[model samples]
Target: MFRLAHISDIHLGPLPRLTPRELASKRITGYINWHRNRRKRLFGNILESLVDDIKSAAPDHLAITGDLVNLGARAEMDAVAGWLANVGEPDFVSVVPGNHDAYVPGSFKLACRAWRPYMLGDDKPASSAGENLFPYLRVRDNVALIGVSTAHATPPFMASGVFDRRQARLLRTILRQAADDGLFRVIMIHHPPVRGATQSYKRMLGIGRFSKVLKEAGAELVLHGHTHLETLYRLPGRSGDVPVVCVPSASEAPGGHRPASGYNMLTISGGPGEWNCRLERHGLDAQSSKFELFHSEDL
Candidate 1:
């Protein structure tokens, strides 16, 4: 069996600290608003606990669907890179950028450059025909991991995302190739493929098109992060049912009760066309510093 662990939305670093003058003048109002709603300062320790938990579980591969930083600040990106380095084993971890990771213009590219060393898979050849925003195809012994960046910086209060035409087309091609190559394809992205589950204002803008491509390609499983809630939804495909699993944030607390911070461990067995998967949730107890199984989904 092959085991894959999926987690997302670490949002590392504390709230931005603006200069007194800037704050007083409302020059940094955006930062202030974000801080007011974000998890205050619980992310770092929570992430540490999560990493320890993942280490113990020791999945064959790790996929992080995005929002590694809160505002795409350079310092936050650096912190995120450091944390990933601390938790990730080379060739085992892969990530895709989320909307927050591209908070400002050009920030997504910057984060990709800074975090490239931790990215898994072979370097693309010069003639490769995919969007180069860390969009990659990774071949593990038992699975083919295809990652795509759906991150885009939108206007303030607009958290919508887009996959762009290039990435969208490339994704179709990659999925077809992987299927022909006889690998269990797992597509990872930051935004959920389903629509209406998200707030109407912040929904993934081009999700319809994205979903169409995915359904046509017939991926075995799809994973996304950004909802900050644990959810499982079935998307129809030509071959059969495709499961899209959305993991809650590893560290987040907007209000009310904080959902459990954990990751999904997926075990796949049997050959192509006869494959089966069992998903188990592994969570960390902050007080005890121990990891335990929180839930399971039979698939």
Candidate 2:
């Protein structure tokens, strides 16, 4: 069996000192939010514990769906790169950016560059695709891991994501190619594509187009993390229901309004027409101050 571990929304903390210029735009709002509220709920220590647990589990591969930084600061991105190095090498970890990673204009480029190594596909070099490489495919064993970016800069107080026409077109092609190869396809995005999974202000746009692509090309599983809550939903595929899963922020401290930080361990065995999947959830146990299994089931 192949084991894949999934985590998201790190929101790595201890915000670096921002120059007046850096906080002059949309970042001002996020900075205020962090200082007033977010920082209390998201802790680096919690993230460290989660990572340690993940290391002990030692899944064959790891997927981080996004929000590595809170305000999308250049220094934050640099720090997150260092953190990623500690997590694992780029080849073993796959990542996609989140709305906060693109909180301000031009920040998206910085995130893409900083996290490029983790988001790259096995088949194509990062140099060849430059910054436009979305729907990247990494073929591992009998699985096809596809990474798609819904991250985009938005106005203040709007934490929305977008899957534009270009991304949709490429995603369709990638899904088709993976299906043709008879591999179990897993699509990774930062935002939950299912409607009502997020508030209206934070909703993912272009989901109809995305659904159409899925309907035509199909995928075995979809994973995301932006709502800071655990979610499980299925979208219709021609052959069967596609499982879409989400987990809470990896850095979220216990006793928050949202559920404690957690991650998913997915075990897949067998092949295309006769595949088997077991999903195990690990999350912070607030009273015990440790991470433990909170849920488990077959999907």
Candidate 3:
């Protein structure tokens, strides 16, 4: 069996002091929001404990869906690169950017450059990691992992994601090829593609195009972040419902609308025709900081 661990929305904190120019754009709002709210709720110590737990679990591979930083600052991106390394090596960790990772115009590209090592596919060279190469494919054992970026800059107070025509085309092609290879395909995106997964201001655009692509080319699983809530939504596929799943922010403190930060552990056995998966959810306990299993189910 192959074990894949999923986590997202780290929102690594203690924001670096921003230059006036940096705050001139959309970051001003994020800065204020962080100071007033996130700073208190999102803690680095909590995140550290969570990472330790993940390492102890020793999943075969780790998939980080995105939002590793609070602001799309160069410093934040730089720090996140180091953080990712601490979590695992590039080859063992697969990542895609989230809405916050690309918080402002040009930030997404910057993040692609900084986090390139984690984002690269097996076919791409180290130098190619900086480009906007979406739908990157990496085959590991019986699993075919595809990284899709829904991360793009948006106006202030808007945390929406986009699934453009170019990405859609690339994704459809990748899905079909992976299916033909008979590998258990897992599509990693920053936003949940299912409708009503999030509120209007934070909704992911291009749902129609995305669903159409999925219906045309079936996939085994879809993983995402950004909602900061553990959720399961099934979307229509040619054979059966495709599972779209997410977990809360990796840095979110216990309580509130968002549950405590956690990671999804998916164990896959068998193959294409009769793939079996057991999902084990682990996270912070409401009354204590100890990491423990919160939910388990077969999918």
Judged by lDDT, which candidate is best? 2
TM-score, one value per model: 0.89, 0.98, 0.97
Candidate 3 weakest ten by summed lDDT: 124-133
Per residue, candidate 2 scores C-alpha lDDT tens digits across 165-186 of: 9999988999998888989999
lDDT string for model 1 (1-299, tens) is 89999999887767556455434432244576666766563456777777877878788988999888777766677777777788875587888888888876767777877777544446565334313744688888868888887788777677778877777788888888888887888989888888777887567777877777877888889899988778898887658888999887887532436565778999988767887889898766655655678799777
Worst 10 residues of 1 by lDDT: 21-30
RMSD of each: 3.1, 1.0, 1.1
Ranking by lDDT: 2, 3, 1
| Colliding residue pairs in candidate 1 | none
Alpha-carbon lDDT, every model: 0.76, 0.90, 0.89
**Candidate with more favorable, higher lDDT: 2 or 3:** 2
Quote the RMSD, in angstroms, for model 2: 1.0
Give the local distance difference test score of model 2.
0.90
Instruction: Tell me the tens digit of each residue's lDDT in model 3 across 1-299.
Output: 99999999999988998899999998999999999999989999999999999899899999999899888999999999888888889889999999889999889888999888888888886778433568799999999999999888999889999898988898889888888898998999998898888899998999999999889988889999999988998888757888998988998887666788899999999988899988899989877778899799998
Q: 94 in model 1: Cα distance from truth in Å? A: 0.1
